[model samples]
Target: DASAMDKKQKQFDKLINEWKQKCEDITVELEASQKESRHYSTELFKLKTQYEESHEQIEALRKENKNLAEEIKV
Candidate 1:
């Protein structure tokens, strides 16, 4: 009976060790993904700002063209 109990305890310990190892792996992977996402977000913000600036410049050019047309009519 004592040997059977020891064997059962060893199996339980092995399972617990495997579970802990898997949890550590998952935590590491999550941290890596979070870091990559943050980097992408920063790049997206910069690109968005550049797009907005270019759009404003285009609007200004259009207005200038309209003013020139009016001058020609007058």
Candidate 2:
């Protein structure tokens, strides 16, 4: 009975160690995922800002062209 209990204890310890390692690995992976998410989010924001600015520029150019056309007609 004593030997069996000792063997069981050893097996339990081994399983605990394995679980601990797996938990650490998962933590590292989660941190990496968060970092990548932040990077992509910043990039997306920059692109959106650029798109808005370009749209404004196009509208301004169109208005200028219309004004010039009217001036020539006069």
Candidate 3:
């Protein structure tokens, strides 16, 4: 009976250690993913700003072209 109890205790300790290691691994992965998400968010904001500026410039050029065409006709 004593030997059986000892065996059971060792098995329980091994299982607990495995779970602890897994929890640590998961924590590391979560932190890395959060950092990557932040980087992507910053990149997206920069691209959106560039797109807006380009759109405004295009609209201004179109207006200028129309004015030039009208002057030519006159």
**lDDT per residue, candidate 1, 1-74, as tens digits?**
99999999999999999999999999999999999999999999999999999999999999999999999999
lDDT of 2: 1.00
Provide C-alpha RMSD values for all models, in order.
1.2, 0.8, 1.2
**lDDT, residue 68, candidate 1:** 100
TM-scores of the models, in the given order?
A: 0.87, 0.93, 0.88
TM-score of 1: 0.87
Poorest 10 consecutive residues by lDDT, candidate 2: 1-10
* Model 1, CA-based lDDT: 1.00
At residue 37, candidate 3 shows an lDDT of: 100
Best by TM-score: 2
TM-score quality measure for candidate 3: 0.88
State the lDDT of candidate 2 residue by residue for 1-74, as single tens digits: 99999999999999999999999999999999999999999999999999999999999999999999999999
Clashing pairs in model 3, backbone N/Cα/C closer than 3 A = none
Candidate 3 structure quality by residue, lDDT tens digits, 1-74 = 99999999999999999999999999999999999999999999999999999999999999999999999999
Off by over 4 Å in 2: none
lDDT against true structure, model 3: 1.00
Clashes of 1: 0
